[model samples]
Target: MVHNCVFSFKLSSAREGIRSEKVRELIPDMLSSYTVNIAYHANNPDVGMALEKDAGRYKLFNSDVGLFITLAFKDKKYTENIIYNKLLSDKLDVNLGYVYENVVAQMLIAKGNNLFYYTMESKTSNHLYEIDFLTSVKDKICPLEVKSGNYRTHKSLDVFCNKFSNRICNKYVVHTKAYKWENGIYYIPVYMIPFL
Candidate 1:
């Protein structure tokens, strides 16, 4: 339950050399066994099995974050993993957006919530604006953006809310901050997400 503290990861393919297609085939079984959880990227504000979602573009999170952390350090000896060393000194200088997203998935799932997200390519740039999580409430959508550390902006959430204000009921920026509500958005502390 280390909710905060900074960490980052660079994308890397699986070390076992399993083809991604084969991995995809095994995912249904994994999901059924609670080995993994999936957050779909939806095209609209629908929930449950009725969502118009992209099966091809989704985020996968391990069902257990502690196990995921342990598996991330698969060294023969504990002293050899560079990440473990950095983590010990509290000097990790990485962006761990995925980690926070994984924990949020766990909390949401534990509270019987299904996960969804939204992403759109920027009109002016080649980059994409991504809302980290999206939930439907009373037929309107709620967009959540997760930020770690002393960050002060929610660019993706802003863009999403601006475009879909009519379809949105609430906007949330979840981070390591005190709970507050301002400007039509709720600033929720990360620890309180389970009760949300």
Candidate 2:
């Protein structure tokens, strides 16, 4: 299920060498205490919204991040010594984007927010631009993108804001940096998510 959370259906299949249907079947208790699947916002005109579960875009995440950390180290026979030290010292050699995303999902869930994200292919290029999470702030939708680093090329956030300017209340790029407003987008630290 973590594979499904990190990679798309096709990419996960290629990486894990399993059929996509099998991935869907593994997490039977979806959106419950065991797991949660964040569905794409289908109402967007370019999204080609589909009612069918298998036809829609989604990202899976563990309901509790504490359990998730333990599950992540399952292959090591419960030996989380290396993982603990690395995380504490901030030197883990793995991609932390998924970890951040999972934590954000857990936080949002704790705050009683249903998870949803948006992704679209660029018209000029084949590159896909994605908003990590879309949350309703008051009456307007807030588009958020999570970044592990300080880089600032958030094409998806930009595109989504431009396309749905009136619908958006505040655009955010969640990262490790201090809170600041650049142009109209708010660069918020990960710890500040709960307040937002």
Candidate 3:
């Protein structure tokens, strides 16, 4: 079974090698077959179930974080000491924001939650506001903005709350910070998400 699964990916024409049109054509099958998941926009009035399913506008998440990590960094042998050590020691230069977001999706799903997120165009500038993950608790939408160790501010969360404060239950910033509540937002360590 393992060999067959590995062999299934034996084709040289993988994601990077394929034309985008062909990849777009395969999305429906990938979605329906549970090979990937689509997270809708939770800020919608229907709480992310927008009634009209738009796969094209959805965000795709890997089924599991571990698999994503392995596949993303498998350009070299795992047994190769240099590459493995850098990854293990956090010294490797890689943009892994997607992996962090994937784990959030997985954790939320494990807690009997369907994945949802929010995005909006900023009025003051050409920039956009994006809330990483949103969950419904007691009929109020809780907005979560994920940040790396070097994030400057939770600007997206602030803007999102300003627009939809009436419908909000909690504002959270998920980062490497310790747990605290200040300025009406909870700054929680990532491990505390299941309790959210």
Q: Could you estimate the TM-score for every candidate?
A: 0.79, 0.79, 0.76
Q: Which sections of candidate 1 miss by over 4 Å?
A: 1-21, 46-49, 73-76, 79-92
Error of 2 at 143 (Å): 0.4
| Two-way TM-score contest, 1 vs 2, winner | 1
The best-first sequence of candidates by TM-score reads: 1, 2, 3
Please provide, for model 3 over 1-196, each residue's C-alpha lDDT reduced to its tens digit, 9 standing for 90 to 100. 0001112232234444554455558767986786676576544723544453343445767776767777777776563567657765767787656766777777787787876666789988999687887887777879888775554488889898998889898889887668888889898877888999
Q: Could you say which candidate leads in TM-score?
A: 1
Each prediction's number of clashing residue pairs? 2, 0, 0
Each model's lDDT? 0.72, 0.71, 0.69
Find the 10 residues in a row with the least total lDDT in model 3: 1-10
**Candidate 3: stretches off by over 4 Å:** 1-34, 43-54, 77-89
Report clash pairs, candidate 3. none
> Which lDDT tens digits does candidate 2 get at residues 77-151?
685687879875778777778878888887887787767777778989999787888787666778889988654
What TM-score number comes out for model 1? 0.79
- State which candidate, 2 or 3, has the greater TM-score: 2
Better of 1 and 3 by lDDT: 1
Distance from true position, residue 81, model 2, in Å?
1.8
